[model samples]
Target chain A: MSDTTIKPRIEKAPVLERITTALPIALVPVLAVLGFVAIGDPAAWLTLTVAGLAMGLMIFIMASGLTVVFGLMDVINFGHGAFISVGAFVGFSILIWLGGWTASSSVFLNLAAVFLAILVSMVATGLMGYAFERVIVMPVYGQHLKQILVTMGGLIVAQQLIHVFWGPDEIHVARPESLRGSIVIGEAAIEKYRLVAVGIGVALFLAMRHVLKSTKIGLLVRAGVENGEMVEALGYRIRRLFLIVFMVGSALAGLGGVMWGLYQETITAHMGSEIMVLVFIVVIIGGLGSVEGCFIGALLVGLLSNYTAFLAPKVALVSTIALMVIILMWRPQGLYPVVKAK
Target chain B: MKEPLLTLSGVHTHIGPYHILQGVDLVVPKGGVSVLLGRNGAGKTTTLRTIMGLWQASEGTILFEGQDITKLPTPEISRAGIAFVPEDMGIFTDLTVAENMTLAAARGPLDPDRLEWIKTLFPPIRTFWESSAGTLSGGQKQMLSVARAIIEPRKLILIDEPTKGLAPAIIKAMSDALLELKETDTTILLVEQNFSMASAVGDTVSVMDDGHIVHAGEMAELAGDARMQERLMGLSLEAHQ
Candidate 1:
């Protein structure tokens, strides 16, 4: 064959070769974990998987708000974790005040409250998202620096406000009675709340994936993420779309917050502030603008941290940050970077 | 002649601290191509952008179909019988050709005649119906942009650089399609760098320099005046580069 014919073949090989080679590299981590379990302790492996899955789900919920804003509107909302905190508080208040339940209540009644709490918090968070976009975000379009500073300021104000309203004392939120007990599977004894959280997370991931794939609004959102200005030029009021995205994202974070509250059974005025670091780490590790990335990153961080705790409980927290730094060093844009095919 | 489809008077625009359009005055006779010719950054695209409310005119009156649209939003301005094709060939690349067309159709009814007319004008667009718009060649994107503008009941369409960075054959095709568009009731304001392309299709030619219209006349009258193109565009067409 001529050089011209050969050139195309050479160029095509790199793309295919990269994927084929990378597949084994991607499997190495999973296989390594499996091998460690097969030789040593299965309990350790199971514990790591449950912890990783739970963390991954939580990260997916929280990062949905941040990524949606970044992907769709190119707006970075640093105050997102505050929305999660708000959702937690709201859910707790609903269970305590409306459902008339306590830590000792039946799991079925608490479960009902959880559903109702999720509904109320989602709506409330959605409205807050709309208002935040309209009031704070509208004026600073395309000004990333301004958005960062303003949203950070919003976070500070929100944190202080939460402290003022909820008081300094950390409050405890109870899981349902049914979910309080531990389930023994093989040699691993996992709490019912942790398992339930994993289930909720999986459901959320599937639902969000479905909405993005199937709906007209989802179509608009995907298009908007790539080219919001064009979406506006096409005569669809993009402001409204931004608001919708903001609300839905905030609600997702709120849902995550509610879930976290149930898992920890504790809420504090600075609960949002404490988790913001981990949430951002998860988002950055997953990929800044991808949902799937959030899940993967969350899972990696969760499992890594849990395993680290097993190895050295005193320094488990450092493991997630170490993973984040290592990932950044390797892939500056994060794993599974949201790149469009040229 | 019947009332002009679109009219602009003393349209002044400022971007940030820079004064862009000083006082561009022009009128588009109903059902004709009015070309706005200028050097780079001479406010040709800015004039179209401002008219479409992409940048609100600092001072001026833009009337489309005998209605004031100076204070309207960009989407509202588009909805008001006026469509703008930006200089960059603003095609939503992530969307499929069909999806892009579908979104445009949602703006207003895409009459069968108009759709057929466009398909006849550019067959490549029809050929790549299901393909992603980003995958299209530059010339095809230009065709899609122009096609999008004229898809509805637009009294006037403003097209910016319909033949920028295109193969010679595609440029000729675009020029021919634009001329055909003029034959229909659609009025057009064209911003162009290629003088020959403008001259071939434009019924009336308006020359802009430093944000002001320096000359306005018929295509023949303007093209005959070599000094005007040199004085305004800073390059003489007769002289080979």
Candidate 2:
């Protein structure tokens, strides 16, 4: 063999590709400016902007798992909402049990109560996710139609189960005392809980990006997303990887459920189902399996919804759908399509 | 011959409703290149896939070093020291070339000496280490695919059509790479449509018609006899020339 180094021909990506890559992130600020202009009130814009960011973060938390699961496993788990509801109810139950801590004026105690709720909900939902994969997801791996039908069926069953345990009526949830009030900043007032949600969402996004970029497991996952059979052929148990991703994704949805439950100060069996519409919108807008795309899409939906709800309350419901339509028109495959061996 | 490194006796594979491989019996000797030649839809890829356990052999047995591997899952078959380079090259387009190689190494960090040796075999693997596998041209992707298979030492490798769709120059380079690879201790079961490329590196040859091996013999013997090649393949190697 010749000791010659064959340098790869380097070609910069064309202008179109660069623009598409940056479009999702760029849309955030552009939408914010559009909101600022349309609302015509700086204070309202600040409040809505923070509210949208916080809402987007929560949606990102819930939708992140679905996008990954869809990307890697090709499983459309409609029952993912069930995990959210389960987590919310489980977390709320803990808070109810720890009423003393939740009611305490001390920030530490209140935070502790909320933290315990989140931890317990995550564990419960994580285990539920494991069972969900084995029982509901494993058998319907390649059949998309069956996956949708069965997982939807699973969602209905889960809701019924939640109704059995938590009852049919909605339960009132109070944010922990320390997280209840708004923090006035300059002329803008932001809810303390929303700020916390934003922080958690940012942390989760960074952590997910880091893991996918640097870790061995992350490498397998990204590879598996592109070609799962190749990942198996390379001697890694891709099924095991999928199972782990499913469980973690379910846990994240559960965590989001807890946050959202407190944000609304209410919990119900139907809450997860109701949120599923928005979650689906985010996943679709983000591209089916791209996590970064999901985050951006979530923010877009969140801001658009908040802005529309404030500006034209009647159009709020259809605003996300309109956004999805416009986005799909621009990139039919979603914002960040995962390039796989077709 | 020395004890066969891998053997398939009356192997039958069923993919979904299609019974692709009726019975494929093959013997790959311990350390030389064995080329499987066949026309399209003749089950050459299926044979490799079955050996790698990507497609389960519904009936019969696959023995790797005398150990039954017919029931093993794809990952277990790979872990048992068998590597497969599928027809599509199986490069993870979303991942960088380095990530692709790292995933294939599976055991631990890539060996520096082996990496250097591979760089000589396929320079693109080194030059484009940080580049996404998707950016590589078809020929470079094929090179990366083969590089990944040989990244770690293995008992045997099943490669499907390494020279397919490559430019004449790249095919020549690939032929040279395979010839160099033959010098190593690894046993290879290669599936190729290009007779010239097969004749160049193959130590042994097997011809498949419709999933069953119709003929098996020394490559030199097959290469020298055009009549036998025509009878088995319905086309002679001379036809390409």
Candidate 3:
């Protein structure tokens, strides 16, 4: 061959996935330190810090399902909030029925009542999620615009159904007697309910991380989220996986609803929709379809929301949105984008 | 053709309004590499996809083991023992290399012997067994893609453009790997543009043009005949070399 012979150009193999970045993980602690420095008062700062952790964890629980569903199915489900409202109602109603134990001083009674509420709520919302997928989301698969409109309609219908079942008036859901007060540690006080929320949130995060990392089903899920078509091509039914994921996501939303209701001591048909603003922000900020990203995004938002509210009340109103904008400006695809192999 | 393992009879595939594959008729004999060669946009990829059931055949029948599978869904078609490695390689970048193979071994756990053999074949697979697939280079990902397809005992493997964009050294390695796989009596239907590798590994060759099979013959015949090569592929074999 002559030296002048044209040869096919060779491309150097890329060292890493395009979206890999260590920055998102560091942002959580960086935000904490920033919070500490900005607030200046140790007691107030510590109190806000715990509140932020609790809030961030709850959002992570809610956003986790949506992110995975978004990743695996490529289906935009605006109706996810309905599961939250239904979950809150279902859980709190179970609590109300156990009225005999609501005022009981025993910690077992309090925990039992709460546990029962969570169980029933998950089951209820899980079933609802199944029906919603079959009846609503299934038809609009791969059609993003239609998915948005139809799922939004589903949300409206769910909200109205909630009103029909529970009445139009907002309901007050008080924490169980044992979970009603706070423990004072030095100069700062932490609500008993908030502490419980923190423990549950962290434990749940670990469990989810373990499942995604070590389990076969979790492997399929991560793969399906990245490329459902490829998953199907590999001899696995992705549609069934999508249905299972949707149901689980709905159940998690229900669980979050119950905890959120207890945390706020209030339940209403509109509560889920209201919280969804933060949930969307977190999903967007934590690259869509990654539970870890969702968790990190939730923490950043929670801390910033709390800190900004303390520092500048007006900025607090749009703090999560502002954070989302800034994060997007930095990483257009968000932190830890689960890129489909192209 | 040594008792065909797969037969596509006048198969037509449509992706939305685009009629990509227009009545493709081909036979893939058992126990060899059957390379599908075509120019860009000639519907070679669509033919493989139609057989895999990724895109449904709007018309005609696809038969494997004498069973009609044209209307089958992708998963059912795969469960019937067909594995596809798309041009993109379809590696789940977020998943670990081991996790990727585990997912492909649908029937049961990965056989230790089989895994060891595969690890030896592709060292990066063993070295990065626990690392995210994203960490691997392009050539390594392609190796994993083929490895995943054969992780379990598949009846046939379909690979699209495996050597599409790679260094010459990697191309030689891939060609050798395909030849080694042939030793085990595995059937591979490869859609490849790299003529040198295709001729080196292919036992049977089908040339496609404008969604139709223009010629099918022994790989050696096509490789030895420069006139036939120009007529079928519109390029001389020497240029590819």
Candidate 4:
């Protein structure tokens, strides 16, 4: 026998028992296509599929940070949507103030404005998360009902604050020159702004994955998620960990808000409240705390909403809710749970 | 013979409004398994919890290696060369055996020599090296907990109950492993209800009753004193043996 043949069957059949294992993260795009096909007009299925995928990518980006905080810290932040709205408004203000929605402003200045807007949103929302953790969440650790009540109060306060500053009227955002118009791929015509948003979302997703795997803080997070008391016992200040996670989560939401503003070109005080319903559906369907699950969940919801809207228009609104119920019925813990080691 | 590594004086702990440890006093010399003996709900577990800094000693001082550590957080206390193995073993059930070991090691490389030593001490851990700790038998989980503590350069190890629900044979093995660990100069504060296991591995014994250390002395002295054993532990010499 050859040396290879003499060896024992080292390739033991890979265990298929991880009921919660993430589907290949690469297949998010593929699943998005499948989603569109299931819900879109038969003639325009492919284009709608691509659009739905793009939409999913946006939702995945928005909810990624929220899910990380949820999974790792066990904190369900209701102010996540508020952060997104803040990012959109901040970005919109920068755009309108610079050039009155005209095409003459330096592209560099516009980019800088976007960055500044995102930065403002990030800092504001991050600080909000920090304070929220210190004042409301920390004292009532492991109390779900208290968390729900306090954070809902926070949401109402944040919405009122947004209205106080930006006013109740709907605000308009202009697409950058480079992101204006449409991209024709094969027989598909897609909005250039939506594509750019998808690109940004993909970049952010990659960066989050790298940080979670490579960074010391990330390891601490994984350990903390498994056992907070043990992590605390290992000399880490749990309070600091909680703060850092909250900030990162809020910042991610802020970035998502910027993307959402760029794509829709509209902002309002209720933008957060509007998208929050979708965000919760995404996170809940994905699984309570799994990033992979959130990504998968977001994309599934995004595509479900987009294609269903494209097909039935009015009836499409219930698509996300339906998918959520179906998912819960199948796997009550969420689609891709982080399986407890047993 | 040497200065005590840990000194607890008038340690009091209250969980919320109810006082758990009321004026407990004890001392553990530098290199021995000092067993804290008591019946269930007699504050034996609370005494360990208080020392490990899980519960703040409301009105007492804990000196570890000559530094007061009563006010420090549990993590800081653990980092100050003391490791705690709780009654539940506090094993991260989601982590694999290897991951659990790595988590426990915290900052250091898995010392191969130490791993080999512990593997020799508790062979089942080697056999179940990749298995999740939650799948292990109760005895095996206790071994993993002790193994996790020993993986670090732990100057002091506090094990709440190493043989709480183990069979007689596994308890014997645990006692033998702890005896070997004691030989390596690791100071262990063990809380146990199993008197035979405690007597076999303990260098000194402190009997706790109603949240206070009622009797404390060298294990040899306590073992030799039949009347003292009956009064403190409610066990006659034959029953204790």
> How do the residues A38-146 of candidate 4 rate in per-residue lDDT, one tens digit apiece?
7455536666666776777778877877777777777667767777887677767766665533355565665666667677777777777777778867876777677
Candidate 2 per-residue C-alpha lDDT over A238-319 given as tens digits, one digit per residue, 9 for 90 to 100: 9999999999999999999999998898899989989999999999998978999999999999999999999999999899
Top-scoring candidate (DockQ) = 2
TM-score of chain A of 1: 0.87
Per-prediction fnat: 0.30, 0.72, 0.62, 0.31
Write down the lDDT that model 2 would get: 0.92
Which prediction has more favorable DockQ, 2 or 4?
Answer: 2
Q: What TM value does model 1 have?
A: 0.88
What C-alpha root-mean-square deviation, in Å, does candidate 1 show against the real structure? Answer: 4.7
Clashing pairs in 4: A233-B75
lDDT of 3: 0.89
lDDT of 1 at B223: 78
Candidate 2 structure quality by residue, lDDT tens digits, B127-171:
889998889999899999999999999889899999889887788
Each prediction's DockQ?
0.25, 0.66, 0.44, 0.26
Interface RMSD, all models, one decimal each?
8.8, 2.2, 7.7, 10.1
In candidate 1, how many Å is residue B10 off? 1.8
> Which residue ranges in model 1 land beyond 4 Å of their true spot?
A1-14, A17-39, A98-108, A312-315, A336-342, B108-120, B225-228, B234-241
Better-scoring candidate (TM-score), 3 or 4? 3
